[model samples]
Target: MREFDVQLLTDAVRRMAAQSNQILSPDVYAGLVRARESEDGLTAQSILDDILRNADLAAGKAMPICQDTGMALVFLQVGRDIHFQGDPYEAIQEGVRQAYEENYLRKSIVKDPLRRINTGDNTPAMIYTELIAGNQVKVSFAAKGFGSENMSQLAMLKPADGVEGVKRFILKAAREAGPNACPPIVIGVGIGGNFDKSALLAKQALMRPLDVRNCDPFYAALEDELLEQVNNSGIGPMGLGGRTSALAVSIEVLPTHIAGLPVAVNINCHATRHAEEVL
Candidate 1:
């Protein structure tokens, strides 16, 4: 069995938090470039151009992509063959605090949900842990800003609603979110799991690269078909109206109880920021 230092996990999380805020993934960048070329509306095209330029500036200058630096959310997969040297949770939180302060990331997290007092250092990152079968620990950081996160939704659909119902539900969610989630978006749809699980699944789906699809052939086809339908809405870049409002539609599915079909839709703005590291 391999023993890993908790400090390494903490440091990696911090680095990921800092990196995600400044860099748009290469796949996302390439997709946006393609959209800029094919988009017909001059105004819409201009908006896309500005977005690309801003992303470039963010990376080059080491500045946060958006003013909202976002709350840090870490997901970990710890292998059964691995042993941790220190307190894992504290390590993760310390990493989050140090990263935000040192990287100059804005501290948007509040201490009390009801009181709304700013924590000042973006500490207390939301972390999820899962045990797996390897000898290494894999950490992924997704800095989710409140603007787009607020626009997400979960629906407990009737069993009779079926796949068509799910399609309509997601479209309606997108329509309601109009321009708020920052157009030229990447949509994550989670279906079949319980409400909370479905919601988390949708957000996690955002971490997958823009061009990748579900390994399941059926879900892959659904992802492609959904992307086509969402783009047809003509929400365009930044809601200016064009053929490329949404860059991709990704879905994650899980088995559910026989009584209900729960669907969750998580919308990520053009500035979707995520990074991962394994140790």
Candidate 2:
């Protein structure tokens, strides 16, 4: 088996945590550029322009893109043939703690759900690990701001509800999110998994590059169709009204039991900050 040091994971996560907050990933930036060009309304076009300027300013100034620097998320895809030398989970958390403290990003995490006490350092990152083949490990990090996060929703639909029901629910979500999600949003959708996994899949979908489509042709079409419908909702940039309510809609799906169909929607604002590293 190949052995890897946990420190590598720590350092990668730390760098991504800080970098993602300050810069928009290339795919996301490209999507915004395209959105700005496609918008016909002057209000929507101007809003998209401002959004692009903000991204540029954030990177040039070496500052966080949005005031809500977001909760740190670390996703690990580890190979079955590899082993970690130290505490990988703890290392990930430490990476988040150090990045937030050193970079002066907002520490929004709470130690307790009910009591809501500040964690102070943003420790206990939301980490997800998946084991696959090969000897390499992939680390993906995202700074998930809660403005659009709070607009997300989940539903357990019957198999009988079918695709149309799914489309309706998704469109309704974009409609209701409106300006609240900070329009020109990126939509991540999870379908056909168990309740919790579906939600996790939706969150992970946001990490997919905006330029990439699902490998499955059907789901890829669904993603395209959903993105079009959402933009047609007339939410526009910053919801003032126009043709670009969402930049992209990414759909991630998994096989599911015959009895259940779980769907989740995770909305991300225009910033859509994410980064990835392979080791």
Candidate 3:
């Protein structure tokens, strides 16, 4: 078995957290640029320009892209062949703590939902771990802000509801989210699975590169269709009015019970901050 130091994992997360906050993912940045160029409405185009400039300035000066650096969400895919020298999970938390502390990223996490006590260091990252075949462990990290998160939704449809039903719910969700979700949003959808798994899949889908489509032709086609409908939403850049309501729509799916069709939509604004590392 290959032995690994949990500290190494911690360091990686810390670096990723600090860096991701400043540098928008390349794919997402490109999508924003394209949106700016295609927009004809002067107001919409101007908004896109400001967004681009903010992104560029953030990266140049090493500043958080948005004041809300957000709660850290970490996903780990580990190989069974590897053995950790320490608790990898705690190490991940430490990474988040150090990142927030050192980089001055806002500590947005709370100790309790009701009590609303601040965590101070942003410890106890939301972590998910899975086992795979190789020795390497892959980490996926996202800094999820609440503006779009608050607007996300899930609908457990009847199996008979079918594709048309799915489309209706999705469109409705986007329309309702409207300006609240921060327009020119990126939507991550998870179809099938149980309710909880569906939500997790949607969150995972957000990490996918905007330029890549779902590999399955079926889902890819659905993605394109949903994207068009959302863009046609007239929500525009910051929800003023334009053809750039959403930057992209990505879908991920898994088989589910014959009676159930659970779908979750995880929406993110133009700045869908995320990063990944394999170690």
Best lDDT goes to which candidate?
A: 3
How does candidate 2 fare on TM-score? 0.97
Candidate 1, which ten residues in sequence have the lowest lDDT sum? 172-181
Q: Which stretches in model 2 have alpha-carbon errors above 4 Å? A: none
lDDT of 1: 0.89
Q: Write the per-residue lDDT of candidate 3 for residues 1-279, one digit (tens) a residue.
A: 999999989999999999999999999899999999889999999999999999999999999999989889999999999999999999999999998989889999889999999989987799998899999999989998899999999999998999999998888888888988788999999999999999999988888999999999999999999999999878998899998999889999999998999999999988899999999
Clashes of 3: 0
* TM-score of each predicted structure versus truth: 0.97, 0.97, 0.99
How many Å off is the CA of 127 in candidate 3?
Answer: 0.4
lDDT of each: 0.89, 0.91, 0.92
User: Tens-digit lDDT track for model 2 on 15-101?
Assistant: 999999998888989988998889888898888888999999999998888989898889999999998899999999989989998
- Give candidate 3 misplaced runs (Cα > 4 Å): none
Superposed on all Cα atoms, model 3 deviates from the true structure by an RMSD in Å of: 0.7
Quote the lDDT for 231 in model 3: 90
